[model samples]
Target: MDLELYQVDAFADTVFSGNPAAVIPLYEWLSDDLMQNIAMENNLSETAFFVRKGEYFELRWFTPESEVDLCGHATLASAHVLYEHLDYDDPVVVFETKSGRLFVDRENGFYSMDFPAWPFHEIQVTERVAAALGARPDKLYMGHRDMMAVFENEAQVRELKPDFRLVAKVDGLCIICTAPGLDYDFVSRFFTPDVSIPEDPVTGSAHCMLVPYWAKRLGKSQLTAFQASARGGVLKCEDLGDRVKLSGQAVTYMKGMIVL
Candidate 1:
């Protein structure tokens, strides 16, 4: 059989800049092993698969190694596929995911994603954490899905060269390093060597944790953020009571058939 596959650069207006995700538009759910294998074969940070369900859709995300609870870039890429490739005419598309209901809307030329915020709390920085990061952060925190390390400035966030082997031993699925940005309100970098992603170019999910922290610290509900990965990308962030809004642009990089 042949499956439709699309590679999209999420949170980027142009190709090859933002996070790249593989999107498979499925009419029916495929087996877990099959999807996982496909994701592994695709070898992107995340591969998103969606099956249409009435006006909304059911979405799942997989890395090369395992399935994740939530993923921001792949979700944006999926929405991009639905709107741009599948001829979806709606301005807003809702998705049922492992994390719960998610909504993506088209506003102007950008795609705005509404995601559930992961509440995080400050944690004591340990020797192991400091060793893994190479540079010790000023503060450390843990969220529902990731551990955050706050640095003094953007230079600290950008200059990081983490020990991936040691970072994999950390308690969380991923580590988020962030600091105040010069161009944007805040800047961040995400590392998930445990799950095979050394660094994510643009992470929307990490911003769920970043947005709340920065909003409370900066005393603002709306903010701008940049992910300082090798292939950097921009994100517009907003903090709501129990949710966060992350807006960015996506473009299709490639489309082809996957034979199985």
Candidate 2:
């Protein structure tokens, strides 16, 4: 069997500056085990597989260890592939995903995605959480998808040196450390030790909760976010009550054929 693979750097203008995701467009559904193995082989943060279903596309995201409910960068990379390489000509691209129906619209060079705004509530900060992140958080929120640790400044968020082993003991899919940004509205870093992603370069899905939180706190609906990783990323965000809009640019870094 043969498969086409494209690696795209999401939320970056040039190559090697953002989160790179492997995208594979398929004609039919491949076995879940095969897809998981492919994701592991690629060793990226997330691998996306999509099949055209009538007028829409069916999308799935997998990490090295397991499949996830939702992923933002991979979804953007898939849309970039369809529009640039696959000759997908449509004003709006719709995808049926594990989370729900997602809509992507292209304008200028940015691809804007509409995603659900996950709800989060305040949670007591425990000693284990403080030990994992190497600092005690000012506040902690238990989000539907992850746990958020709020700090005083962007420097505090950036200076974190998390112990992944200890992070696994904390409850949440991932630990999101965020604070008020120096330039942008907010800054964040994502860590998911259980899924084999120790520190995600630029996590779009984490902004689902961050946007809403910052929007309400800043007293504005439109906001900007910066993911303070080694590669880094910038995102234009908008809070739409129950939904959030994330927009960024993606560039194709490499393309090849995978033989099995």
Whole-model lDDT per candidate? 0.94, 0.96
lDDT of 1 at 183: 94
Mind sharing the TM-score for model 2?
Answer: 0.99
For candidate 2, write residues 143-209 as lDDT tens digits. Answer: 8779999999999999999999999888988999999999999999999988999999999899989
Give the runs in model 2 whose Cα sits over 4 Å from its true position: none
Lowest lDDT block of 10, candidate 2: 189-198
| lDDT score for candidate 1 against the true structure | 0.94
The alpha-carbon deviation from the true structure for residue 137 of candidate 2, after best TM-score superposition, in angstroms, is 0.8
Q: For every model shown, what is its TM-score relative to the native structure?
A: 0.99, 0.99
